[model samples]
Target: MDSLCPLTDAVIGDFAREDAAQLYTLVGRGARSHLKVLRNGLEISEMAVSDLPGNPNAVWTVKKNIEDQYDSYIIVSFVNATLALTIGDTVEEASDSGFLPTTPTLGCSMIGDDSLVQIYSEGIRHIRADKRINEWKAPPRRQIVRCAVNRRQVAVALSGGELVYFELDLNGTLNEFTERKLFNADIACMTFSEISEGELNSRFLALGTVDNAVRIISLDPNDMLMPLSTQNLPCPPESILLIDTPNDDGKGVAAVHLNIGLQNGCLFRNTVDNVTGAIMDTRTRYLGTRPVKLFKVQVQGRSAILCTSSRSWLLYHFQRRFHLTPLSYANLEYAASFCSNQCAEGVVAISASTLRIIAAEKLGVAFNVQSFEHRLTPRRIAVHPTKPCLVAIETDHAAYTEVTKTIKRNQMANDVEAMATDETEAELAREIAMNLREKKLDERVFGAPRAARGKWASAISLISATTGEKLTYFELPQDENAKCLALVQFSKHPDAVMVLVGCGVNEPLNPNTVTPEEAANRPVRGCVYTFHLSPTGDRFDFLHRTETPLPVGAIHDFRGMALVGFGRFLRMYDIGQKKLLAKCENKKKRYRERERKRKASES
Candidate 1:
């Protein structure tokens, strides 16, 4: 559940968004239709691409103009090989291949503040904001496959396994562009990265090839592009994201953190040496059953990966160390075929009638009880020392009877009965159908329990606070009812923490045979159980338990003393003395106005 989410898709062609909450999606096939999402829901407006000058049908790509932040312009590419800019309800034509003499085929495109770069079968062309055109011939008979632009630098991947690098000088002139043949196979995707202080002044070009390989190429301003390292993937790489450590002002980069998505639904994470571009460590995890649109996103302040697939949205826990762990996910009404602005908190996705804003914190996650079983309800939570998450102690409620397993098996049996039996056999057919309906109703009303599977207990769950992902769960024996919990970490024991759990009776021990008087007079023996949390924070080891005179409502460790709160009194027990020091009765009035707060004149 942490790694997969079912999502509703609106079957949009492409989408674009500037702010985290607003989105525009391309809908319809023959007639150009668009959907606008404003956080709450999607609005199918009566606007079409035909309202524009070019009357475009399919939208190939859509990107927001970064230079104009307030009232930003949206750069759009059409299947008709045209480029247009849109803002609000107004649309302006940037370029169209139909206007050209030969009707050149457009392969890839990039947008800038006042410029546009379109790659075609013949070569690459630059369209300035002033409408000036510049063209450069590509390698003989080779089409540009993928291209990425960052500021003045551009990296283009050609279908013939060659890479072309271009940089516009300060004088507004293109320098001698460099070409390097690196991959034996054609590159499917590539991204440009600028050098940082930690990289020793080395820039990079990361490429994912059609042959299931990722090549990190280091490019120096003076030297030719060279392959720094190559890693083979289990399937063809579909998407590549390079995450970097940011400095103040959120601009300077220090390290190379990379995430790669494969055609086989496998997502890989790696840390690369910023200078040499050599990969340091690699970790891979299966994200979904179908191909994924893997990209980084901020979900409720937690950095996560939104793996939008044909089925649902899979959000993974992303650490700066370049690792993808299961965080949380949601099931969709339909598969999200198109998505945009994948790095932010709000993601625009459309499928059929649903236009959804796939926000990380609001979407599905493992920590959300709704993602899994409902019997266990979280009682206590403790924040992790380093990670931005919480360690929760959850207790199971005994009131509900979960019918998970039996209902499933019974439904399968009913299916066999329905197939084997004939409708002419009215009694048998009706009986089987009735049983099936009853089984479904039972499951719907009463969910199954862990005790049915021969397991009984409470559990500790490590959950991401930002993304709401239940990372790991450690089940405890059901002997004790943990009412209140506290975690104490000593400086000497940096790797482990001491866990103190206060126990209370949640249910009667022998309610069936005991008389009413016997149950009423039963003693409430309180206990404080001690445990040692594992170094990895996944499991716990029981140490010992101490008995108390009265039932404990809450507990706190104050100056080496265990302060226990009860219903009528508060008790403080010193650990060194090994005995209770004092007990104080609760005061009806919490404050004495004159004694606590003095008037200004009296002072």
Candidate 2:
């Protein structure tokens, strides 16, 4: 309970991790001149952002979502914690920063959100910016915490079990707004569901309280006093996930995960119809025996439920008998937060940076798929909300690859691939065969569907992505310390994927540490090996090349965009071309100059 996931959005890694890396950008095969980052989120592999032949509008990742006339997301890099925006998409030179206070922050709350947002403390903020925003401070609260902005409504839980809500107003300054109270109880979380147009009072908000109770709060903001239904569940609900069914009976299901011991987690579902709040069916099933602190639950169908935690991810599909299926996964250290991105039909999970989007519907098999001997463990993973591909990975130390022989097998599918031919590729195949000879992969990475297609990760070392029936295993390269792995693999040649190994320099070069001036004269150098990897698994064509200007801490490749969280700043790399289109550039420059002059005059 003390260790919160610190993952507000599952797609992006922690700001510290991402901000530490430098990113390298490249041009995609098609779709040139696009403004996107080369890397997305935190991943070992680069993103394939280019569109296919027929799909010109297709993009690998979605940067932001339009929140309406007031604001729209323009730029977001966890390292910066600053979101750039346009007043409206059409408003030229009218941009805003979601910085609220315009400072480096570790925590954010809903201040503008009249609902659950009040004020949060015990977070990080920098001096340079905080001084400017809080100069009007009377009480002089030195350190502050940040809150979330866009959850629409807010729910505040007081000491004695009381919940309240208020109307959100972003149109005017904060002081000139009205507050509407909602409930009474210790609210764990509140989710607004089922809104009817023209009928304000008909909107229903479900509240889960500390007493393990469920209350349906109905309100028409126009008339604040309120009349809503308060329903109680038999069991104290640990976590509540709301899902709607298209049966037209106004029926929906709530997946309730009750807190059990580490090895005995139970998930139960009770059906309720909205038009007439009535209980239809309630079924409880013991899913597994693992205590999950930070688990995100997303409902696909009445029977299909996806639960993701730091340890593992489970897709529970109850057909005839209750079967708690285990999707194949290996070692995973840290997981932030993952969502189905509201796309629950075909495939759904949070994507890079947690900005959800639907992936293309087709799947293909990898030409070569093999396990490694290093036992690659995964760190973070995201699922394509509409597509079948899953992106699982481990936290990167530098850039290297680990060949894992530890095979965790579950269900098996008819698979065929052209085995590696060259000596190096052949050696890799032999290694995988010997490691997987005794045990099958299906048994280890269980909880998978017979006709399963998803992503799997293990030990922060390996990431396995399955596109329909196609599967590709990304293993870390061996390092001198055997602790680091390859972070980025780029193929300068069409046939090779560049390999970057991870390494850290040793301190205390002498018996004792050197002074600043002495150290400056002879500074220790960081190490990384960059070489070519041919499809034939050939020799390292060019090995042991170090990158200059050093590299950023976090690196990701999404299609043509390279996002490097560099020194608390998010660097966006547009790999579409060497430069911007000449025509557009001139017009943009002129517009910017004119706007700058006008702004200066007005000021």
Candidate 3:
């Protein structure tokens, strides 16, 4: 991916490869105008256009034969000029660049006989291979927004909400055939359908407008630019396609199906009558979370519509039913368009920087996996109460080392301070330090050695629900390892949601020195931590911490109170007051019986 040469536009044509079409991309702008040729995702050649006077806007390629071999003539239109280059296989075969002066060029297309049609802000220009230029200006004050051309017909949309149709003659001249004025809405995108057999020109024009509606216009010679049918959409349409459906009798075309892509990541489909143009059997399906752009491509020797959004999806027919499936093999992001050229049974996708060609043997394999990398192993997860986010607790290999070190350090420091004043304290300090050393050796002999213990670092991450992107993260204290998480709202602050985390301390035990009764009498240590959500919803702000004598294994919100599990007991606390409300033994049957008797007495 070249940031210096960002891809602006691309076109596919049957240039030099007889087996597959080649891709030509226009990159850079103004003084940095350049062209790159690609086939099957490999760049074959690139040419810089320094002689051109303006920034390149679009590119078009036409195939011609020279010396009985096929050659491609590439034309790049700029703001005020056009550059033409002829090439065979490489840049070495490119002819001297030819320059044709013109008005500011918005777009250009090949219209047969080696003639090119260039559209400008005001009108159209017909430039021939002989360097002859013919001009046809539209009515005054009309500015062209978009233009689509076929073999013999052209459709130009204006900024002032008018669509003007044109007919091309054998002499390379454009004649204004008909025009229609849309009252209040401007056309966003428009395209001419493929020419059918026995028909000289394309028979229909599909227009998507800013008014959130799709209008199908008849382009037949009898009723040119006539509005056949219009369907309202939930959102503004981004792209539209017209596909001809076969008649039930196996004769000719029966109805034209319209596939519209909307701004809200949805595909709208319906069938239009070939004769009456009435729309029916409307349906819509969500493809992604971003705006959808539809493209026609050939997949597995069959026609399919590629919907490019957050993820690319292929819509095709299988077993007499239309199936919309995502392309599992190709993971494309920010894709502008796709074509079934240069790769066998695959697609060529153009994104912001590179052209990716994917060969998909099996189209939809149900592989939509997202992965997030973390240095520590995740132990617990909790979902946000009101937002589409998650809180995950992760810990390193030495999950308990931090707690043991903190306790040892504090005990040693306190004993040393008191030893200077009393001989008894000095004796206690030595005994405590010796006990710590013994515990360390026991851990090494029973489990991992001290050297194998990693530095303690526990962390929690906030993750997005939709895109799986990490939003924010915070590290826990050295003495704590996260055990459980919950989103709680206290009684005093019922409107505010807070994240609650329960943590436990880790310490080594020596079975050789301690009896079962001594082990059972050992104190369990833990803490409960709380945090508030930031205004932006991306970060967690530390609020308060509550220490517990027993290891906290679980936490839950019960009627605006925090129900915390501490080893064999359950305690309820009023978070706002920082006071314990109730305590109960870990016996469900006894608790339920007491609750039932209390309710009976109250009744």
Instruction: Specify the highest-TM-score model's number.
Output: 3
Worst 10 residues of 1 by lDDT: 28-37
Assess each prediction's global lDDT (C-alpha) against the native: 0.51, 0.32, 0.62
Off by over 4 Å in 2: 1-96, 100-152, 169-185, 194-202, 221-236, 247-264, 276-280, 289-306, 309-327, 330-603
CA RMSD per model (angstroms): 20.8, 28.4, 15.1
Model 3: colliding residue pairs? none
Ranking according to lDDT, highest score first: 3, 1, 2
Off by over 4 Å in 1: 1-66, 75-85, 89-113, 194-202, 247-253, 296-305, 311-345, 348-603
Tens-place lDDT per residue, model 2, 1-603, is: 312122211232221122212121111111111111122221112111222122111011111222222222222223323333232323122142323333333322323322112232322211121222321121244332212122343333333443334343454122311443434545554445433333322245555665656655554455442434444554444444444334324345433222211213455455555543444465655544443212223233342334433323333333323333333322121222212223222222233333222221111211111122222223334333223333333322322222322222211111111366678877776666555455444422452222111111222211122211213443333322212333233222333344433332322324265677755764433333343344433223344434323223444543433334322334433322222111111112356788999999999
What does candidate 1's lDDT look like per residue over 1-98, in tens digits?
A: 22222221122111112112221121221111112122222211111223333433222223334453222223333334444443333444544422
The digit string of per-residue lDDT tens for model 3 on 530-569 reads 8886544577877777888766789999888888987667
> Among these predicted structures, which one has the highest lDDT?
3
Estimated TM-score per prediction? 0.44, 0.32, 0.55
Assess candidate 3 and give its lDDT.
0.62
| Comparison by lDDT, 2 against 3, better one | 3
